[model samples]
Target: MAGLYTDQLKLGLDDVGWVFAIEQSGSIVGALLGFWLTPRVSWRPLIVGAAFLAAVANAFTANVDGFAALAALRFASGLGMMVATLVSACLLARSPNPDRAFGAGLTLNCLLNAVFVWLMAKLLAESGYAAAILSAAGLFGLILVLGLALSGDLRGDFEAPPATPESGAVRLAAARTGLAGLVLFGLAINMIWVFLERVGLSNGLQAGDLGNAFALGLLAGTAGSAIPFVVGDSGNRARMIAITTAGLVAGIALAWWATDYWTFVAAVAILASVWNMGLAYYMAMTAENDPTGRYTRAIYIAVVAAQAAGPAIAASLLEFSHIGTVFAISPLPAIFALLLVAAVAGAPRVEGSSLAR
Candidate 1:
C-alpha cells in the first residue's frame, strides 16, 4: 500500500539514488537494530513499540515539509519496521513445531504484504497518505494491546537439548556456513528492492506499472519460499543458492536489458521467484545451524549490512552508468560467497552452536 503510492510519500528525492537510499536505509537500520534488540528485550515491547513508531513515523513522512525531517522520519520508521520484523521472526523461531515455525515466517512475509498493500491503496484512494498512515497507526495500537496482554508464554526459557557433534570442527563448520548463507540471501533482496525499483521508475515506467511489478515479484517470492521444507536435510542447499542466484541475476538482466514494459515485468517476476527461493534456503540454513535463534541476531546483522551495502553499491554504479548497469552487478557475487562459506553443509550437529535461543 505504501509502496503503491510512491507519489503520496512526498520527499525531495529527485535523484533516484536519494530515494533508494532513504527507502532501503530504514529497512537496513531496522534489521541491524532489531536483530540485536530482540535477544535481550522482551519481544512485547519491541513489537508494540516498533509498530506504534512505524505508524506515527510513517505518518510524519507524509507531512515532512523538508528533506531533513523526511530523512529523520524514515530512519525512525526503518528502525521500527526492523524491530517488529525481528520480534516476529524470533517468535516464529521459538515455535515448537518446525512446519508451523516456517509457516509463521511465510505468513508474516506474505499476508502482511497482501493486506497492508491493499489497505494502503484503499486508504490512500479515499483519504490520502495521512489517512492511510493513521489507519496503520490504529492497527499498531491494537497489536500493541494484544501483545501486551497475551504474551504469557511467548518466550522459550531453556532451549531443547543441544545437538552434539562428533567433532568440534563440525560445529565450527556449520556456524561458518550459516553466516555465509545469510549474507547471500541478503544480497539477493538488495539487488531487487533497491536497484530494480529505481530502474523501473526513472527509466520511463509508470507508478502503477512499477507497483504491479513489485506485487508480482512479492507473489512469486511467497511461492518460492518453500524449498527447504520440500528438499529436507541432505539437500544441496549450496546448489540451490547457485541456481537461485543465477536465476535472480538473469531476471535483473532482463529488467535492465529489456526495452519493453512487459519484458521488464517478466524479468521482475523471475527475480521475485528466485529471490524467495534464496530466502527460504537461507532461513533453512540458519535454522539448521542455529535452531535456537540465538545466533539469529548475528544473522540479522549480516542481513542488514548486506542489504544496506548492496543498494549503496548499486546506486554508485548508476552514477557512473545507466540504471540498468547498476542492477547488472548483483546476486551472483553473493551466491559465490555462499558457496565459499556454506559449501561443506551436509554435516552433523554441534553444541553451543546453532545459537538455539
Candidate 2:
C-alpha cells in the first residue's frame, strides 16, 4: 500500500528504502522473539495477541504525520505480523501434509493481497490515503478475531523434540542450507519487483495499466501457490525448485526485453507466480529440515532480511550501473543457493519424509 502512494507519503526513494528496511528489521526481531516463545508459550494466545498488536499498529497509521512516524508504525506492524505468521507456520509444520498446508496458506495470502491491491487502487482513486490504510487495519482486526476463535487444542498438537547433540547437528546443517536458499531466492525476486513500475513506465505503460498488471500478477501467484496444495508433494522437490529457479530467470529476461504493455503484464504475472511457487517449496523444505520451529524462525528472519537488502542493493547498483546489470546479477545468487539445497537434499533423510509424525 505504501509502495502505491509514494507521492502522498512525500517520500523519496531513499526514504522508501529506509522504511522497508526498518519494517523488515522489526520482523527479524519478532522472529527472534517467536524462536524463544514457540516452545515456552501457548500458540493460541500468542497468535491472537500478535494479530491484535498488528491491527492496532496499522490502525494508528491513519494519524501519522511524517516519514519518521510512518516508519515507526510500519515497524510495529511488521513485528506483530511476523510473530503471528511464525506461530501459524509452527502449527502448519505439524500438519499431515506440510507442503499442502504451506501452499494453501500462500494461496490465501496471495488471493487476499490481489483483492486488496485492486480495492486499494480503487479506494485511493475515490478517497484519502487514510481510508486505504484503515481498510487494511480493519482486515488485520478481522484476523485477530479469527485467531481468537481457533480451538485451544491447536497448541497441544505441537511438542518440542528433546534436543540431542548428534541429531541436532545434522538437522541444523540441513536447515542451514534451506535457509541460505530461501534468502537468495527472496532477494532475486524483490530486486526486480521493486523497480517493476519504473520498467513499465519506461516501456510506455500508464499507471493504471501497471496497477492492473500487478493485481493480475498477484492473482497468477495465487494459482502458482495452489500447485503444491493440489498436487500434495507427489514429485521430487529438488527438481521442482530447479524448474522454478529457471522460471524466475526467464521472468526477469522477459521484463528486460518487454516493449509493450501486454508483454510487461505477462512478465510480471510469471514472476509473481514463480516466486510464490518457489516460496512454498522452500518453506516446506525448511520445515521438514527443522520441525522444532527454531530454525524455522531463523529461516523467516533470513528471508525478511534478504527482502530488505534486495531493493537497497539494487538501488545502490543503479547509481553505478544499468538496471540490466542488476538483472544479470540477481539470479546468480539463486543459482548458487539452489546448488546448496540440492547437495543437502541428496543426503539421506535424518527425519521422515512427508512431514509425517
| Local accuracy of candidate 2 as per-residue lDDT tens digits, 1-357 | 777446667799999879877888789889888778777777878899998888888888876778888888889899999989888877777666677898898889887877777687778779978788787888888788888887766652344466666556666676677777888899998888888888778877889988777766667667778887887677677777888899899999988877777788788888987887777787777777675666666657777778878988899999999988998998988898788877776765554332111
Per-model TM-score on C-alpha atoms = 0.76, 0.87
Candidate 1 error regions (>4 Å):
1-10, 14-29, 59-70, 95-100, 153-169, 197-211, 226-239, 316-328, 346-357
Best by TM-score: 2
Each prediction's Cα lDDT score?
A: 0.62, 0.78
Residue 203 in candidate 2 has what lDDT? 77
Candidate 1 residue 141 C-alpha distance from true site, Å: 3.4
Clashes of 1: 5
